[model samples]
Target chain A: MKVNEVPQDGNNFKGSDKVKKLVYAVDKDGKYTGVNTKGWEAESFATQQAWAAVEEDLKETEQQVKEGVLSPIAYFMQKCLMDLPLLAKHVGKWQWQVKRHMKPLVFNGLPAKTLQKYADAFEVSVEELKSFGK
Target chain B: MNSTNYQHCQHAHCESGVTSNLLKYAGMDISEPLAFGIGAGIFFGHLPFVKVSGTPGTTFRTWPGTIFKQVTKTLGVKVHTQSFKSVDKAMQALDDVLATGKPVGMLSSVYYLPYLPDAFRFHFNSHNLIAYGKQNGEYLISDPVMEEVSTIKPEDLIKARFAKGFPEPKGFMYYVNEVPPTVDFEYAIKKGIKKTCFMILSPPIPWFGNNAIFLLAKKVKDYPKKLTPRKAALYLGNIIRMQEEIGTGGAGFRFLYAAFLQEAADILQKQELREFAEELTQIGDNWRNFAYSAARLMKDRKSDLVSFDELSDMLYNIGTEEKQFFERLKQVKW
Candidate 1:
């Protein structure tokens, strides 16, 4: 059975790129889509390790952001925001449009579930979720 | 006369006073922080918007940094950051920024969570403060909650405003120095036009948050050429201003601001200085009464207030006044 993630649809510009990366990052033979329990169990440790590394690296940046030393929006756009396109095969127009809209507002509108996760993790509103948006 | 020498307002609760006493000397109804912030915003060539929230949200950045950026961009002011980790260092930064003759504003995020009406529960952002320079080292701040001006050292304000916890930093704030990029109103006008014309116009129903106003102004600029730049800019400012005041639970006051702007525009067109003067006098006198009544309503509904009705009414009025203003402008037999 597939584990439930947060409420997210591939509604952003970089979803395809993100999915591809996720597939590459997780799958050994580049086979994604349907996974068996055995496959899930096999990759669980690897995924956890990868996630830990990413999270650890991000913590330093998060500290800088909180200290007003850097803009997390800028950091996310430069790093993870672009990578989100690897997640899905098709990119929608509205996602790109929203991304463009957010550019002026200091966001690039990547369909990363991280901000929502951050919100959930912090027990704050989704809109109030500070993101390193990977 | 230096930035280090800046002072705060003399009003009660006048914490961050860096504005000139010129208004006070002129017998103006000067409220510290509020007047200072508005004046400083103007002096720095930006419009001020006030936001008061009961809590600070995780997603929301510091109010001063966010607003300083938005207002400066909207008004076509170029701002640069100066580093000052201490009060003395901040004072020197202020002096240096001002010495160059560029207008300056400061952003500070005070962490004081004063009890607010429960209705403001949705807002979890720090009370935002923006102060702009007047003459010499004197600056004014548009403080939303204080509703008054108080003069203090620029360093004190930066500390009081940005320092996170008690026993606040003895250092400086994140200072914002601004000036019209080209010092030419025509350039500013074109910039304003571009901003208004190229952005998405969010429906006025939600009432613009501070940054949203900048985007809305840009969206309006993208309207058809039949709406002249001057008209578009004026309408955009008035629209945002009215919407914002109403959003903050000042329905009656918002109406007056809207109506007075209508009358001001009319008078400007007619070149009827005498009538314009009289209307200005009347507005000045009655605006406070409107504000008082609105404040009382807000106080009563402090815990559960949102003015959807007032917002809709203002949108309706905007449509009417916009058409009238455009028609008058077109038919002016100059």
Candidate 2:
């Protein structure tokens, strides 16, 4: 496989903040040197596409929360890329309790102590957890 | 104590780059690939049981800190490493080490780091950087993945260090306490090669070694039937991101490993290793092709853009090639 060389023209990178990546470049003597990314077309495009997908997911979750179709806990869990089991482990709560809290009705009825636990797990305040995306 | 003498150079991977940089600062010159290979950094594991961002965990390298630990140990370098439960203690301990004029290596989350582009800032918790000193209220960082040295606010650094998630860093940091006058490169090189070959070829579980490639391929092939279309696309996207985005030096560290083999061949004056290096480079290209096809499938979600079976077949080919490569690598009498 031919090593993809960084393009000579710097315009290949899209973002204003110059993002540099390490690429293996061979010198005239055939010795490999780690060089900074001016830009590689394929890698740059792939990274952009991946982040666009993530942004889309974030927007979709926010829309769901605004419509009250999903609880704030579910929104955050998806946003953080966390599953119930992992979130439960972080908060020291049972998985069943976490599942119950994902219901809007149940989450609204929860007292401050339980809400605070969920908040800590998500690294947000109880107020933020309750009123997320409002 | 200051970081005036600390030199930073870009490298294909972070941990190996940090290891190389740290060793160089301590008056030893070791290339990143040498550090990576001698540290036995190359690996493959596709663990469905382990989850990252709702997708099965796929790691192309060994667990964080393994390379640094292994390289320093093999070279007979004494080091101090610690993980703290409290943020206050972790910061104080880091300061204490820096006051003695030694640079500190730390594990941090990319999400909380301000220097990185927003596109790259996911909730990844195992990113490594060097905290060489404190300037005013900020810590001077030598993040190998970045082109230039950067700084981090004290509070943000703390948050990144104590990030909440699986593989939590917990303010983990390390520094060299002592170094020998010279290291036996030949011995370390042979040992590194042997260990890497064993790791790639010997895992018993289907989720590890060369088996992992096939395992992931099968999982990817079934994504369309097992998951909703949106979910399947997201799953496929994350795999591509892991492979291409998070600084595996392109082709999931295969290119970096090939570079290391070339260096090793020259250092050991072994003609056979040079030939093996070329073979691995070809394998790295195959992995690149796999990433390209996978990325195309992800970018265009239309059903006919690229079939899952075609992508899976590409991965299967990579697996077959790598299995044979490692088998031959294991038999080399260095």
Number of the predicted model whose lDDT against the real structure is largest: 2
lDDT of 2 at A58: 76
Instruction: Report the error of model 2 at residue B143, Å.
Output: 0.6
- Candidate 2 runs further than 4 Å off: A1-17, A25-30, A38-50, A76-92, A109-134, B303-306
How high is each candidate's TM-score?
0.30, 0.90
What is the clash count for each candidate, in the order shown? Answer: 60, 0
Model 2 lDDT, residue B34, Cα: 91
Task: Residues A62-130, candidate 2: write the lDDT tens digits.
Answer: 887788776799888767656677678767888898888877888889889888878876778888899
Which residues of candidate 1, in runs, are more than 4 Å off? A1-134, B1-79, B82-104, B110-159, B163-183, B190-194, B197-334
lDDT of 2 by residue, B216-250 (tens): 88998998789887677667666666665678776
| Per-residue alpha-carbon lDDT of candidate 1 for residues B1-334, written as tens digits (9 for 90 to 100) | 3334333332211121222222222223323322222222110011223211111111111123333443345444444655455566676665555565433444443322222222121212233433435443445553433334334444445434444322223333343333443433223223322332222132243232223323333443343343543333233323322322112211212222222223333423544322332332233223223223323323343323423233233333433433333233323332
What TM-score should be assigned to candidate 1? Answer: 0.30
Model 2 RMSD vs true structure: 2.9
lDDT score at residue A23, model 1, on the 0-100 scale: 11
**Residue B123 lDDT (model 2):** 78
